[model samples]
Target: MTRAFIFPGQGSQAVGMGQELAKSHSVAREVFQEVDDALGQNLSRLMFEGPIEELTLTENAQPALMAASLAVVRVLEKDGNMDFAKTARFVAGHSLGEYSALTAAGALDLADAARLLKARGLAMQEAVPVGIGAMAALLGLDIGPVEELVAEAQAKSVDGGICVVANDNADGQVVLSGHKEAVEAAIEVAKEKGVKKAMLLPVSAPFHCPLMQPAADVMAEKLTEVVIAPPRVPLVANVTASEVSDPDSIRRLLVEQVTGRVRWRECVLYMGEQGVTELVELGTGKILTGMVRRINREMTGSAVQGSQDIEAFLASL
Candidate 1:
């Protein structure tokens, strides 16, 4: 069976993720050490012993998720007996986790991954003023229907602003972003169309939308500050559901991803078409694992973040 390694993005982060792996394996501990040194702070401590709110901040959440993803990669390398470089067909990640997938496939160094994510997080948070931009989850609505709703909202835009669909996440789950009032209008439109649940997301900014153009510019500048190599395995980019390795293209996509749709459902579909029968999520939570099931019901989904989960996955392999 063809295997693909996937990584989780922002919402998958939890304060205590990867702690058990660190405690069980010296290699996993080293991953945390490297990230701590790279960022010049004890992110590990915050991860293992968090004062919840602090770990939930965008700045911390971004790197923390990457750290967990890379830590699981270390375990699979040093303990789980799966060398992705030797076996996996391809690697892909959802959002910020794209960097983690790049790190796992040896395209970017862990230090650069950690540092870049920090800059990305800070830039995204500062992109739109709080309470101005909003994101709303439109459940039970097909992507086309959500797009229709976004168009309806845009038809009534104020201040030359508009709302747009930001994430085509799953069969019936999509996210919309724009000015707060526009999002509110979209929510009402979705409700009128009998949407199951259209509610505002509690995010610091309206990510994956035009409103995040400032963040995209910031990522463009910061991405150039690092050195990246082509990954050992092909990486399905977020902006395009195709595999890419060119450093310049990678840089360009990183910027586009800031203000572009996540296209997560498409990314997963691409992996499945390439014969990825088993998808392993290497991060703090099983968010991607669950989505993999929704995307392809025949595919098996599992997380390998903790020491026990690592052992179990190794057993299955």
Candidate 2:
């Protein structure tokens, strides 16, 4: 079956993630070490033994998740003898996981990816005052209806009110992000429209919305200084949800993604349309794998997070 390698984003992190893999494999351990050197901090320690709150910090979590995903990819290459350049048709990631996908696809170096994510996380956190912005998931409603609701909520709102779809995650699950009052209003509207659930996300910032414009600006500056190579495999970007191999386009899309909708559902559908029958999630959790299945039941999903998983995947291959 044709395959695509995908990576997970925030919310998939957990204490002790990648610890077992590191303990068992030298390559995995080295990946963590490289990230630690790049960031000039012992982030792997935090990932292995977290205070939960500290590890959950956007600055720490962003690069930490990427490190874990890359560690898995490194191990797979060393032990599994699988070459993504030849085997995978496309690579994709959710949110910050896009950096992980690029690193795996050879478009970015792990060190640069880690440092950029750290800067991105801090910039995003500082974009808007914490209590001013919020995010909420509107379940059981398609994107078409949610867009209409968001417009209505914005129109009725006061001030520079903005509530936009952040993640078109899957069928019937679209997450909204923007001003607190506007988001709350949208949640009420969603409930009134017979949505199954509409609730606030415990996020530090209203990510993937206009509120993150400052963060986008910060990323634009940071990305310009860093080199971006053409990926070995095509990347289905988060903002566009389509294949993009050009380095310049990839760089611009990465910045736009800060304030653009993470068209995850569309990305999965596009991959399926291109005949990618199986998707492999390389990270701590199977969040993207679950989303892939929901987006297209015809596609199969698998995850490689530990040594056993790698062995099984290689044996299957």
Candidate 3:
């Protein structure tokens, strides 16, 4: 049976994430320290003792999550001799988690991963002004219907209410993003159409839509500064739902992901079809692990978030 290593994206972070790992393992602490050094600040403190609001900021949360994921991986490697090629057949991530996946697969160093995530987070935050854009989750809606709803909402706007489907998260769950008015309108329309739930998301900005074009542009320039190497393992890209490791291709897709739909369900389905019977999430939250269970119930799922979890996994092996 093939195995895959997946990573969680944004929205999975919380205060005190990776705290146990930091306190338990020197290797894990080193990962956090490396990230702090790379960013020239103590992000670990913010993550572990967050003022909540500060850690929730896009700029801090993005790399903070990446650092958490890397810390888990470092502890796993330091405490458990889990071979990447032997233990994992594929690697995939949700949105920002893609950077963690690349770093785990040896495509990028931890320092570069931290730096890139910081750049991405700041760029995305600056893409649109606060409170101007919004995101809503539309349940029980297909992609085609959701796109139609977005178009309808956009058309209803007198100005630029550019509502668009951002994330096709599951079979019937989609996240739409654009102007606040447009998103609210789409929610009302979806509720009228018998959608189970249409609720506004608690996010700093409307991400993964046309409004993120400015962020994509920023990433295009900032990514050129980082040295990206081909992955040691095949990566299931978010855009294509297929495995690719070409450095140029990875760079192109990273920029596109700024405004592209996070095809998470598709990526997991692809891994299952490609013979991944085991999926492990190395990070602060089990969000991606839960999604994988929904996508492929037969696959054995594991989450390594602390030194003890890593040790338990190693013992099992």
Candidate 4:
């Protein structure tokens, strides 16, 4: 069966995420150690045992999630000899997980990916002051209605607030991000439009929207400092939902992704159209795998996050 390796983004992190994997596999420990050394912090400790508040911080959570995901990838490679280039049809990730995908596909060095995510997290958090911006998830609404809702919300912004679609996650799940007032307006509008559910997200900063342009600028500079090589497999980028292999294009898209909507639903649909029969999510949670089912039920979805999951996947292979 054709396969694609996928990774999860933020909100998938939790305390004790990769502890068991590290204990069971030396390879997994090595992956976490490399990320810790690269960042000069014991991030693995944070993942294995966390004061949830600290671990949930954007700066810590981004790289921490990547480390956990890479630990799984390393285990799969060393234990099963699964070379992504030959075994997988494509690689893709949501938001910060894109960095994890690049690292797994050999496009970016592990250390570089860790450092880049740290910088990205810090930049994103600092782009807008806390409480000034917000994000809201509007359930039971498709992109078309959400876009019109965003327009209506924007029109109601007397203080020039901005509200736009941030993540097009699945058929009925869309996230809006921007000025707090604007996002709040979007939530109200969504409710008025008979959305299934509309609630403000508990995120520190508005992500994947124009309010993050400052973060995008910082990433533009940080990205140039790192080296990006061609991945072993093509990456279906979150911004465009298309296959991209050119290193230059990858770099450009990474920068744009900071302020662009994460087209996750489209990305999954594109992969299905490309004949990817299975999506293997190598990360801390089954969030992406669940999204895959929502996007295309015909496509199988598997999430390998722990040792047992790893063994099961290898045996399947």
Candidate 5:
């Protein structure tokens, strides 16, 4: 079977995400330390013993999730003796998880990835004023109908700020992001469009929409200073829903991702079409795996979060 390694993003983080792995594996511990040193802060402390609110901050959560995924990858390589270059056909991540996928594929240093994510989180958080932007999930509606809903919402929007589909997550789960009033208006419009459910998301900012242009501009400048080498495996970019290995193109896409739709469903479907029979998610949670199931149930999935999960994956291989 052709195997693809995937990584989770934002919402998957928890209070003690990578603590167990760090305790059980020296390699994992080093990964955490390396990230801490790179960021010049004991983010590991915040991750392991979170007050929840602090750890959930966009700046902290972004790097924390990357650290957790990279720790598992380091363990898989050092302890499990798994070589992704030889065993894996492709690598992909959801949203910020894309950085984790790149780090796993050896395109970015752990320290660099940590720093970049920290900057990314801060930029995203500062892009729009609080309460001026919002995001909501519109369930039981496909992309076409959701686009229509967004259009309707935009027309009736109070401030006329753009509202659009931010994440095409799965078959029927699409998330909208933009001006707060527009998003709320979309939710009301979705109900009349026969949507099963439409609810506001608990997010600090409206990400992956036109309103994120300010953040995208910030990334354009920040990413220029970082060295991006071609990854060992291809990454299915969130903005393109296709494999990209060219370093320069990858850099451009990372900037665009700030204000572009996350085509997660299409990314999963494309991998399935490429003969990825088994998808292994390395991170805190199985959210990506669940999305994979929704995109294509025929593709089998596995998750590696801690020592036990890593051991099981190694044994299976």
Candidate 6:
């Protein structure tokens, strides 16, 4: 069956995520070490033995998640003898996970990915003050209704704060991001309009909205210093929800993604339309895999996070 490998973004991280893999596989340990050396910090330690508050910080979580995902990829390659270019039809990621996808497809170096994510996380966090911006998940609402609600909320917002669709996650799940007041306004509007649930997310800053323009600018400069090669396989980008293989395009889209909606549902559907029958999530959690199943029941979704999951997946191949 045709397959596309996917990676998870924020909210997938947790303490002890890659500890078992690092213990079971030498290659996994090397991946974590490479990330630590690249950043001049003991990130692996943070991942394995986290004071959850510090590990969950945007700066730490971004690269930490990538490191965990890459560790799984390295083990799958060494022990499973799997080559992504030969084994998978496409690769994709959500938000920061896009960097992991590019790294996995050999378009980006692991060290470069780590440093870039660190910068991205820092920039995103610093774009807006901690309490100035917010994000909210509006459940049981489609994109069209959510967009209307965003417009209404923006109109009602204090000081004209912006509110917009941040993530069109699934058929019934969408996220809104903007100034805290605007997002809170959206939550109230969503409740008034009879949404199943509307509540603020625990994210530190509003992501994938105009409020993050400053962070996007920072990434634009940061991206220019990095070398991006064409991936061994096509990457389904978050901003475009389509396959892209050109190095220049990938670089450009990475910047846009900082303030652009993560069109995850569309990305999954696009892959399915392109004959991808299975989506394998190689990361810390089964979040993306679960989303894949929600996006299309006909498309099989599986995750390979631990040693046993990796072995089972490889054996299936």
Against the hidden reference, what TM-scores do the models get? 0.97, 0.99, 0.95, 0.98, 0.98, 0.98
Task: Report lDDT (CA) for all predictions.
Answer: 0.86, 0.94, 0.86, 0.94, 0.92, 0.94
lDDT at position 226, candidate 2: 91
lDDT of 6 by residue, 177-245 (tens): 988888898899999999999999998999999889999999999999999999999999999999999
Query: For candidate 5, lDDT tens digit of each residue in 246-309?
Result: 9999999999999999999999899999998989999899988777777898998889898889
- Candidate closer to the true structure by lDDT (higher is better), 1 or 6: 6
Residues 1-317 of candidate 2 have per-residue lDDT tens digits of: 89999999999999999999999999999999999999999999999999889999999999999999999999888767888788899999999999999999999999999999999999999999979999999889999999999988788787758899999999998999999999999998888888999999999999999999999999999999999999999999999999999999999999999999999999999999999999999998988887777789999999989888988888877
TM-score for candidate 2, please give it. Answer: 0.99
Task: Identify the superior model by TM-score, candidate 1 or candidate 4.
Answer: 4
TM-score computed on alpha carbons, candidate 5: 0.98
State the lDDT of candidate 3 residue by residue for 24-134, as single tens digits: 888888989999999998999999999989998888988999899888877776667677767788888889999999998899989988988898899999999999999
Q: What 10-residue stretch in candidate 6 is worst by lDDT?
A: 149-158
Off by over 4 Å in 5: none
Which residue pairs of candidate 6 clash? none
- Give the clashing pairs for model 3: none
Which 10-residue span in candidate 3 carries the lowest summed lDDT? 287-296
What are the per-model numbers of colliding residue pairs?
Answer: 0, 0, 0, 0, 0, 0
